[model samples]
Target chain A: MNELKELGEFGLIDLIKQDTINDHSSVVVGIGDDAAVLLPTPRQLQLLTTDMLVESVHFKLTTTTPWQLGYKAIAVNLSDIAAMGGVPRHAVVSLALPQSTPAEFVTNLYKGMKEICRAFGVNIVGGDTVSSPHGLVINVTVAGEVEPANLVCRSGARPGDVVAVTGNLGSSAAGLDLLTAGEWEDFDFAWPLVTAHLTPRPQVKLGPVLAAAGATSMDDISDGLASEAHEIAKASQVGIKLYAKQIPLAPELAEAAGQLNKQALDYALFGGEDFQLVFTMEPGNYEALLAAYLDLPVVKVGEVVDADEGVTLVDEDGQAQKLEARGFNHFRQEE
Target chain B: MNELKELGEFGLIDLIKQDTINDHSSVVVGIGDDAAVLLPTPRQLQLLTTDMLVESVHFKLTTTTPWQLGYKAIAVNLSDIAAMGGVPRHAVVSLALPQSTPAEFVTNLYKGMKEICRAFGVNIVGGDTVSSPHGLVINVTVAGEVEPANLVCRSGARPGDVVAVTGNLGSSAAGLDLLTAGEWEDFDFAWPLVTAHLTPRPQVKLGPVLAAAGATSMDDISDGLASEAHEIAKASQVGIKLYAKQIPLAPELAEAAGQLNKQALDYALFGGEDFQLVFTMEPGNYEALLAAYLDLPVVKVGEVVDADEGVTLVDEDGQAQKLEARGFNHFRQEE
Candidate 1:
């Protein structure tokens, strides 16, 4: 009987997360991942996913412009397609907003969305716009095409497949920390993290690169590395042993963590919204792929193992440890 | 800033209807229609769209059940596809709800959707469901395949193409009127109208049949016939002259209207939500189709004319008269 206002936006979102029951055969990556992929045909798989961002739930109206909100709403969906190792081709946007919503705001949102759409070569085909009973709700559905043979799922990693990550993690998480902590004085130091939180750069260009390099299984790390690794473990029916020393940490993130007196390793392992590619590679090809990936920095951080071992983390001193999933859980809180 | 609770659900929907703006391509039919279609495609094209009714907006938590909501939602969208000269094939559902939504409700909704899905043999291949800030939102996007050559649009009716309608109109509207008015005494009369309002049977099977018979253009009369007629006229660059006497009226509906002391003709013309195909036929084939359709009478009541004349209603005396678009205008009321 609690009113929605009592729960606020995040509380409502948390409540919603508990409702998802993913049991579809075609779902390669369901709810928790960046996007859900469904194979329609062998040659042409269709990826359909949607993300809705309420004005208050996802962003603050005082700080974020309508354009950024709109762009981010769309970018997040496109990121799902990228996570599925597919190219986004078409998008349909549906919006429910208050009548008082400024026309200029709507136009600018379209402009921001078109900027990204043009870059990704995706068409803004058709959609519906209606008045929202409450706040603005932007829902985007992106349809993508991928060859079944090239499609990657979280379940394909084998025992010997080397766990690797592209780019760094925790910057967005760090940015959120800074925002919540009121560390405005460090604006220069925290701007990247802030921007990372706002307009996430989904790695669409890197999907084919990883696939071409023969990634056994792959997924985007929207949740923290530890959480995503746990997912890969559960899906592939294998265990993962991550090397804490091997995690790439940006200097700014490390410093911020140091200032906050929180473990930077924890952030890198469990801070999500990175949208970086995480894949398992054959150990034999790891060295070559590693060498070839000089520019991309395919950091070998772990290896898949027997399920009996479960997923664990090894410290720099070679101490074996069990790693907790500290990433965002839609239904369950990390704390 | 009045709380949403004050407006309640229906009031909120009315608020939404008020702010919607249709600015893109020639919207042959817009917000109030079962499905909205656009022109400028290679050939005349029909687009069917529907959003699912969740526990809140279209249905009441205390009065309506989930299964009914789901069935009605899909039926609403199917009605759109039927409105067009398109055969339903694929559907994309976007669901938003809180996690607390009972699994039973979700499953029942799907069962309702699936039953309808199976009836039409439409594939529920792809959609996204996420936790909502409040209440459940199910948006269904249906893509029906139509031969580009024989495709019918709301705007293709020339002045000479007879304004003939299939089946009955105003029954659904009358049913809604009764439901809202709390007049539940006439079970026989009210049941059909109520059922018509809740689970509208879309004439999907007949779309192609009408098209193959050389229908000049077609549109589903989701809104009142007059509103849709205006759309067709504006799109086709023609005016419509309606013969009130010739407008098809079901005897039962007439009786119900008479008992209610409501203008039966007005309900037939302006009371919307009758998901019947109001199509035009070439004068030559009109008689043939009319004779062939014995089960559902196709009554010719009007003709399309040059857009300059606008829309006119001819009384029984053959005197041209002006008719207000008394049908639903989601935005006009607000403006």
Candidate 2:
């Protein structure tokens, strides 16, 4: 038997995708999208997205608090809705915990979830609670509503579309690196990256605006900038060309990456959990989209191309290399 | 800090429900019901329900196959929707599996899931896949749809409503007991009970009929008949009187219980995982409901009482005893 690590995350997704057959005609977009888009009613499309976070797999108790765990769990799932240009309306949270888990921890966890749900105008509807033998595991399913015309999906990209991103990347991975190394407080540059790693603000409000502004394709950068670009490319059957220098990096991330003897570009291109939106649009649509969301940092980093070109990244030195679709694979850690 | 075992299942739910303030008017029903009923559109209501199954906590891999695991995972969530008298439309499955899990195991798991989803006209839409360091954990979220008038909630039970149940009780628990006993092949009574424990067919068809016939309140017997009665009583602020004689038990379960030197009645009253719908309705509604689903087994087991009387159980000898709301509590097993 081959190891699941060899299959990689995308390979595993392909496996699940191959066998998945939709029985309901209501399902508009199924397995491969950021969220499953369903036409439950004629007037609007309903979005369904789910995420599971396991102890020591997605997060470690030593590195993150329960509040942050609960907060990030909800944020990441909502990010999928945001990526789809939808308004998140409700969430059901399921938690599996060991008996030793403190009651106060559970309360703080829900408090963190509630705080985030309140921000997005989403309600915490219901969930299941069960016991686990090892450590705490949290799974959140978020349901959102979007107008049919307003929905943006990964398959919408076309040749001549401008590849763009909202907010900076690399800072989150840098933050996680610092947290893993410990002594984060000893360095002044740690807080910004650490906060980015600990808690991410999902592109909730900006998603609909981008969709309304005629953004063609979009995805949340939970799996890194380069990896998400591959997703959009694969889904749309188009190629993407990204400029390395155009990849945004925060000053704190650069400083921390330098201090840690790693390239910030590595964090931007291959690191995970930024929770930013990487999208594509027609060149004519970029100006209005940029002008409308001036409050948030948005940048053009690439262009959509013919499928034969593949997903390629150009270095600052003008070296063009095909980017491998890699970010984080959980099974790899087992080895 | 008190260990979470002391909180009990209902107590923990109360804690979560206490602070779950709904932010949207779209959420018509929240934490207390089988599934959260949301007014996603004015024309119809949306149902969202989530359940998490931890390895060892929910099932023993030694006793159950990956196929059964996946099948039951989907079955339990759909049961919640059935308990709400809704039609399940789609599901998002999230699984956390250990690295050593076989690729074939994954394939069979999905095969089991797809088979069950097909039975109910439900679609497997999207999901999350990640690695678990411990044993496997499966979480499934099912979204269902029902007319606003067809929605049945735990809070709707009233005094004089006849308690109704679909399918016989205790067979599932009895099956589990036989499976755990580990010599099930030796007994003829074993197959029926063991099969009942492994593959529970949720009341997907009969639930809507019950609702249309005017069921006042409903719940699935995931937690045993007594506990479900306690749920309706607590939610509707009513009391319940269940007759021990009326509680249905299969002959196979009784024979198996006799061989194992355990009372089948205990399994019927106090055991769990039956996945049968236990509901209440006006006595006049019973005949119409029964006649409509003549092929399915539907019986009246009790009646809803005034709140002051509390949830009580009657013996075959005509003696009444207050029933304790005890079923399975995961945290309690930790000790």
Among the numbered candidates, top DockQ falls to 2
| Pairs with backbone N, CA or C atoms under 3 Å apart (clashes), candidate 2 | none
Model 2 residue A263 distance off true place after TM-score fit, in angstroms: 0.6
CAPRI rating of model 1: incorrect
Instruction: Report, to 2 decimal places, the DockQ of model 1.
Output: 0.08
Model 2 Cα lDDT, one tens digit per residue, A81-115:
88888888777778887766765576667767877
lDDT of model 1 at residue B97? 58
lDDT of 1 by residue, B181-223 (tens): 6756555777777677767777878877787788876777767
Lowest summed lDDT window (length 10), candidate 1 chain B: B32-41
Deviation of model 2 at B128, angstroms? 0.6
TM-score per prediction, in order, is 0.79, 0.87
TM-scores of chain A across candidates: 0.82, 0.86
Model 1 quality (TM-score): 0.79
Q: What's the lDDT for residue B325 in model 2?
A: 82
Question: Looking at model 1, how many pairs of residues clash?
Answer: 7
Reference-based lDDT, each prediction: 0.65, 0.79
